[model samples]
Target: MSFEDEWAECQKTANQRSTRMQLNQTPDGNYRPGRAPGGDLVVHDNELGAIGNEAYGLYQHLRTQGDEARPATFAAATAMTSSSLSLGSALYQVHDNWSTQLGSLKEACAHISNHLDYSQKRHKEDEARIATGMHTVSKLYDYFK
Candidate 1:
């Protein structure tokens, strides 16, 4: 069979399997695994903190070192512009394009760092709020009992 036919067959099989629980289920109706019945969203504080830290580090590195070649590039472009060679204009254009791309990359790195830091802080606040609500609910239940 052709690649397309094989791919379609695979997709059909996947669709059929997806409709049923393939694993993590026992013969009984109850879930056998230690996990919750429905899908759960879990996040680790350390992992998120590490990602934010790494993004910030990358931002700092890019800000400090990514522009190291700017001076040389500018100087070369200036020299080429001053010269009467036919490639002078083209050289300056290349320099301009490089500078633009470098600036864009620097901005992207900063954005990633800032976004990750914000997400980490917001996640902490959300977790604290959830924990406080749960505790209050548990106390209410104890009083009722």
Candidate 2:
């Protein structure tokens, strides 16, 4: 399959995983091993944060490349409207998805803040890490072949 197909498949896998995680239920009505019935707050937080970060990085990459008319990558780009508005709309969808996911990330960050005793320095460091992660994501996509 092509890159876009692979990407969509990856998304579907993630969605399936997330849904399974969210809908977990034990017949005994008690927490399960490794995963709390309510879900391990830390693990859930981490998963949400990670998914948010990925979506953000994806949005950035799509915004950077989507309007560049990359027929070399996505064949669908060929029939796409040449209008900036159309491209912008697609890019905006990515942005909007990222924005929605960002809430979950912020909650995860808040958990970190609580554990870290509200250290501004640590929070700033985490922000830097996020920026660096976002940059690395672009490189990763290209490097993955």
TM-scores of all predicted structures: 0.61, 0.23
Off by over 4 Å in 2: 1-43, 70-145
Candidate 1 accuracy as TM-score: 0.61
Candidate lDDT scores, in order, read 0.69, 0.52
For candidate 1, lDDT tens digit of each residue in 12-55? 88766533332223435454433435535455667767777787
lDDT of 2 by residue, 3-109 (tens): 99999999888766522222233644454434645643223445545655565555556556544544332443333434433665565555556555655565554
Q: All predictions: root-mean-square deviation over Cα?
A: 14.3, 27.1
lDDT winner: 1
Candidate 2 clash pair list:
none
Candidate 1 weakest ten by summed lDDT: 18-27
